[model samples]
Target: MASEKSVRIKDIADRLGLSMMSVSVALRGMPGVSEKTRKAVKACAAKLGYRPDPALSALADYRRRVRPTMSFAQLAFVTDYPVKDDPFWGYTNEFLYGAQKRGQEYGYNVVPFWLREGGMTRKQASSVLFNRGIKGLLIAPLPVEDGHLDDLTWKYFAAVAIGPSMASPQLDHAVFDHHHATQTVLRQLHERGYRRIGFLILRRRSTRVHHMPLDAYLGHQYRHEEDRRIEPYLPEALTAEGFWRWFDDQKPDVIVTDAPQDIPRLLAQRGLKSPLDVGLVCVSGQANELEGVSAIIQDLKAIGAAAMDRLHTNLLRHAYGPPQHAHGSHIRGHWQEGMTLKK
Candidate 1:
């Protein structure tokens, strides 16, 4: 039954038989408070359910002869996809949850802004953020065809890219090593005595032109002298019919893809059971379980959380410029062994 009105520092101080200033320093973990006294005050404060009003604390500090401290107003999570329909919402939700938890601990709030709403141009987005006094940004992976953000100025705020390295010279990014991930999957398939491996991917200008996984798949296929097949589906196509036709024709013994559901359904339609006539491995498994599909699970949630951590570090150090290629911190893909692969 403790409402916000009853959870003040004075209530705690009165109960603990301590001065407000002593209790304040102890609660804030500032110096000048003895260890024993601090512990006692903290225990009493917890017992009374005392919580400091952040707004009032900021105001009080400003009114005193103290130098103004930069309070975290808002950190913007910008994405090009529509909020409701984007397939990557699950990943985004995890990222936001991680960010919110960390932001609360550091005294900040995260604000999400979708690019699909109202046709947000870079200039318009920048103007809106500037007006709202938001100086931090975390950009999720945008379509590669959208190209680099040319309209937004990087000098005004700190920013970080949350996925693959876009061709932007004015941003810091944290991205998974797509080549490494593909190599891992291919190597696993190779070790399992599966020689004829094929890759299916959506053919997009962005993917064909810039995606590294496609290049890696092609390179690996050529190097091993394995019978390689590629079924390039239309970028906008997601029907089972097109996938079934391709599956019937290629008839690869083992295949790797991003969509697990489509692969299983296609196989089922063709009267081919997985791990019997064909093998399956999903490159980026987004679903709850692999079901029958073996997958190279890239922990995207961890990637997003790490990106925020890097962004916060850069902001604190005031380092803003082109994306520096970070060494030593590699994005490792975890292999989930499933029943889809043949022994």
Candidate 2:
């Protein structure tokens, strides 16, 4: 017998005494082929070690089908904060959780990149990312001083920011609506007959709280012509000693802030309890318990998930252009009727 070359569809058809088209149809598991014949074709193909050419299959199928490589692609979660000691606590971790969940679904792996040690120059960071095959980037909130990030671009990559707004208009992003969120929270407080509400913000002028809540408070006060007060403490002044000094002097009836754990404890030290002497609400309520705390509740996990969805759309659709200003989903937080708020 002639040296039998690896069997092709033609050989199977010749052995089965069927037309090549019928054998091809049976092998493809297409309709019109009898079930018995389909099984026989499959068995013969398997025994002959016959493999379909993927390129030919793709051409026949017309629709492109790219199988994900078993190896996971790296996705960079870049931020300016220190990796080990992020001041926002669960904020970055929750965002990573969302990213990782989506990444696993799409056969990719997430790798966090912290720009510590004086930060990496854009060129240096880009080179490192390129070398690592990081084609997707989810930029967490960067300080305003980080300068222009528009220079960071790649041919086969998609990038998104995960904060309220990016200074650079050249990057796509999804962020919390601090202004609207503050407005909603304050309006709810006002409706609940809390006229003398006060806002306590950390001293850092660059922090988002300084701009969102503080500004919204000022704006709401002007719009309603209601008497209002705001006390700004140094970021370091978030300590118990520093909070007490301001609390003693300002004496806000109801306070809106982010530090539920520390600030509420300090209030109790002075023989004050929420909803009785004063009401307390936090802008970002990631604290362990909300029994006595009302908060705006920034959903960091949703923000991360939205960022990944946007990145995936951009990559798959080949949407490359200057960053488009896209608004993210703003989940309006409900005013939890904690003991901290009186009905």
Candidate 3:
């Protein structure tokens, strides 16, 4: 007698003088197997000490769930943003495009679920998604203050978050390589004969990314000449008054910032012009918007695509709830030369 682990359904079928299909249906209690045959199959299975193998069941299930031809399931991009103020349409639109494209490759369509407009509580939204057969979630960036995602039922789905903004529940995340981005910016500025570089960042943005930029900036300055080191001005929010004060005090030859929209005007107000009186560089800049500012083109879409990839892998492993050991995937961005910084 073979061990139960070595027994196959076909082996039972051979002994019972029934077809493999009948044996399978009977042992599994499917409709095609009558009561007498089902009982006989069960008795024989017991006598043979037969047991189902989870690995075989999982393999069959995986084959059933994923096919090369077309999508069989959906992934949700869950956000708390109001439709009108959706970040996806603004700075993060590229991220959405990336996620969608990658998801399609794996036969999964990524759909947006706006949490605020629907007026559904997190639990309600979870229920709706569960009913709709959504098994994976790509949690987008939320307000920096709202670190935890305790509102959603974490156990029901496999999830990965976009960026450090999703702090709690601590799912695996994909983020811009802010630390590297900052380093690249500083190195570029140094190579271009600029010193006394100051960073002006809104406190919220700095906090949202766990101060990686700040740490990188400080670390870089530490190893450089003392004259080249300038203190960063981190106001609670960006303001013209605060900007001038920092400008007057630090006298940075070049300013590095995430928000560059107001820098041109701010420079103008102080009787300064970019690349002449001052060099302004945006650490995170979109190609189209920051027309004249030298910047690091953060690949937001690539980050989204990475997050989708992580979520897909988790779903394949049937991983749910908080990860046992959370991880982060960092994406490096490229530098775009603009008119604001000296070439």
Candidate 4:
């Protein structure tokens, strides 16, 4: 049996009739070697029981930290939203910022690529990414009508989707725990003496995420009396007229919605007030920033950082393509108190 010390990169190189430099580059996932050559080199190394030297890896990591130019790893944040009026602008910005910040810490540059603006088909985009040496992807939550990216070359890179929107490739995902977030908010509201808490969201948004929040709400309702449970107010789109109609019909003591904007305004139109006549809470992003609103604030920045962490872990383990087991991570959002909910 060949011992670890007996197997080396040069030994594998000589057996494969390749240069030591080529073998070294292949093992490190550098650009010098073709993908086929890299695969061959890795196979040979595995057959020979080759293991990397921990000290050397540590040294390389230190050098990469001290001198970023020494490393060439690049990742991408793929999205369809444009720079202006981005659908996910406020909600997903933290994810972008966190991914970029953490990626840099690991000597990997994470850049954003707008799929719509590029005017390229999925195949064309893949070619561009391949030529640019982008070996990792952080897919953002997509619009309801378009989410799947099946044409992209999955085998060539590691990928982690931000949410359930990118469902086709079924890549590993990092997402806010919508179920837990809803349960938490309901629990808090109940504790605060709110019985009839109404849940509201755009129908498309809820359906896009497989109605995880709605599921939680439905599940929680069973725990309370029938009158205490309010059916969710799902509208096809936002309109003051539609919302007012629902509000009037439900007559809820509190409202829980993804969009907290205009809740006060809508309440004012009915000669009502938040926490005085009706209470309000948000199960969305930017909750802490909402004045007078208690919320289950989704920490998008933390979710982004977590996604990068998962990507890096896969890179280190030589895991690529759609994950065999398709691991997913759900980060629970925190409860933030403002003046929206009564004390």
Candidate 5:
């Protein structure tokens, strides 16, 4: 029997007449080696009773992560938004930061690639990315629409979507769990001694995320008495008259909305005080500068990091183009205490 120190990968290379690098990659189960070569290397190692040193593997992983090696690869963070630095893209900024941070740990650089930049066509952009040795693409969330990948060369790169907003490419995706977020909001409000919880979202916006918030809130409401259930304030076009009408009619104790910041300003028109008149809980991103609104805090940075991890897996497995069966990753968020509701 060969001891771990006695037999080495160089010996395995000598036995098979293969390069030590090939043998090492094969033994580590990394890509770039053929299946036949990998099998032969494994068989030869077993025959020689070779064992790997655990200390070496740990040190390699530590160095690769903690002090990441040279950046040898790049991942394109694809987006189609016309204005890259607009305030509307704040969420995009956070997601990009997370992805870039995670990519650095794996010896990879995350670079943003605007789809409409320089008026370049999709094919031109694809060729540029491929020629630059970018084999992975992280599709950032854009407007909700089908056929997001039409006419683009899709067979070259392993791709992943940052959120549910990207409807095409049929690639793996990571998104905040909207349904879980709404459930958290409703449950937390009830626990805080508030009933008649109401939900409000734009009619058009609700459909974009598959009506998840609406469905989750409705599911919670139906479990109680009919009178305690408040119909969600979903309107095609929301106005002060319409919002106030719904509020006066439903008379909810707490109004949960996707627009916490906008709601306070709107409420001031009627001189309706929050928490004193109606509690507000936000399912969307909270404005830290704004106060008195409770919220479900989403770990968007983690979601972005997870997206990079998923894309890296596909790159490792050589899963390029659209997958036959796409997998969706849903990351849940936690509750944030605020002065919008009283205990």
Candidate 6:
């Protein structure tokens, strides 16, 4: 008997007395093969210890792509963003730019699709993707965290989400390590001799990232004297009244938040200035717009690149749909020193 290393698809087919094409289809979980035959082919291949040759697969993929009749393969980067006044839209682009650049290196195009564009329904949008022969989907983070989108025809494609923002039909995802970033921010702030630190992120931003920011603030606070622990201000709405009330009550010597630039304006309104009366450290994002605030700037482009690499692997292994054991990565960000911290 030949060693399993020498086993090929032909060997599996020969044992079952089936054609190579039928075996290929069955192994890929594609249609046109009977359910019983598909099962048998898989079992036989496993028993024979047959595996695909990576180099040959690469050549085949190249040939299939170069043919004039075949279009360059594409992956869809789907989102549900508004056409106008989209607050988070700019930040979302960092993910797209990274994924797009990485995808180009793989000879794959990453295309964006809007879920609510021109009255097209989610079901219809899915059809467009399938009809266009796209088999990979890169889901953008939802506007609101903890949302579910079950109407998608998930069975036809290999899917990955940008973050944990999606709540239902959980998919493999790549995201920044928020908890790690929080710890980093806290350590830096403490080293600056600040004792009382307060956290404030209006809206569901805290919940969106699974409350890592709020949790980190509390954890750090508890490590200090009980008098140093200040309650965080997390509200559904952003208002001056709420902000001043929280500031008066907490009187945090330094504040950690998602938006440091905007915080200064709010402080100035009450005749207070950052670094004069308070300090600010941003953990959420917008590194460029930090306005001289100490921040843990996320490498969002890396998250996009990681996601693309995962999708490429899925395409290679023929892994489609939601996975039984979904796995992914969390890219870490670096700190950017700004004027908001104490010298």
lDDT of each: 0.68, 0.67, 0.82, 0.83, 0.82, 0.82
Candidate 1: C-alpha lDDT: 0.68
Better of 1 and 2 by TM-score: 1
RMSD (Cα, Å) of model 6: 4.4
For residues 1-343, could you state the per-residue lDDT of candidate 2 as single tens digits? Answer: 1123556778888877888988886765333467588778877777777777768776754432244435566788887664545665445778888877776655567888865534777667777877786767887776553335666654435677777535664467776667777787787788778877777766553265337667777787777643455454446457776677776776677887766667667777878887788887776554345555777666667777878877766654345444455535444444455557776
lDDT of 5 by residue, 1-343 (tens): 5666699998999999999999987886555588799889999999998888879867876788988878457789988887765577767877888889998887778998888888989999899988887889998887564437756788988889987776776789988899999988888888989988878898878877878899999899899889898888999977888898998899888888887877888878878777887798898663454355688877778888989988877875567799999988898877777888877
Model 5: number of clashes?
0
In model 5, the clashing pairs are none
* Of 5 and 6, the candidate ranking higher by TM-score: 5
Please report the candidate that would top TM-score against the real structure.
5
Worst 10 residues of 1 by lDDT: 61-70
Candidate 4 residue-wise lDDT, 1-343, digit = tens: 4687788878998889999989987887755678799999999999889998889888987876677664647788988665534754666777889998888877788888876654788778888887888888899887654477888888878889997788687888898899998989888998998888898888988987789989988888888788777778888987889988887788899998887886787778778887899989888666556766788877888899999989987776667799878889999988888888899
Query: What TM-score do all the candidates reach, one by one?
Result: 0.66, 0.65, 0.79, 0.83, 0.84, 0.82
- Cα error of candidate 3 at position 105, Å: 0.7
Arranged by lDDT with the best first, the candidates are 4, 5, 6, 3, 1, 2
User: Clash pairs of candidate 6?
Assistant: 292-339
For residues 72-148, what per-residue lDDT tens digits would candidate 3 score against the true structure? 47888877665646545466657778999888876678988776655888889888988887878998787555477
Of candidates 6 and 4, the better by lDDT = 4
Better of 1 and 3 by lDDT: 3
The backbone clash count of each candidate, in order, is 0, 2, 0, 1, 0, 1
lDDT of 4: 0.83
Residue 249 CA displacement from its true place in model 6, Å: 2.2
lDDT of 6 by residue, 156-246 (tens): 8988899879887888899889889999988988888988888888757888888877777777877889988888888898688888899
- The stretch of ten residues in a row with the least summed lDDT in candidate 4 is 81-90
For candidate 5, the TM-score is: 0.84
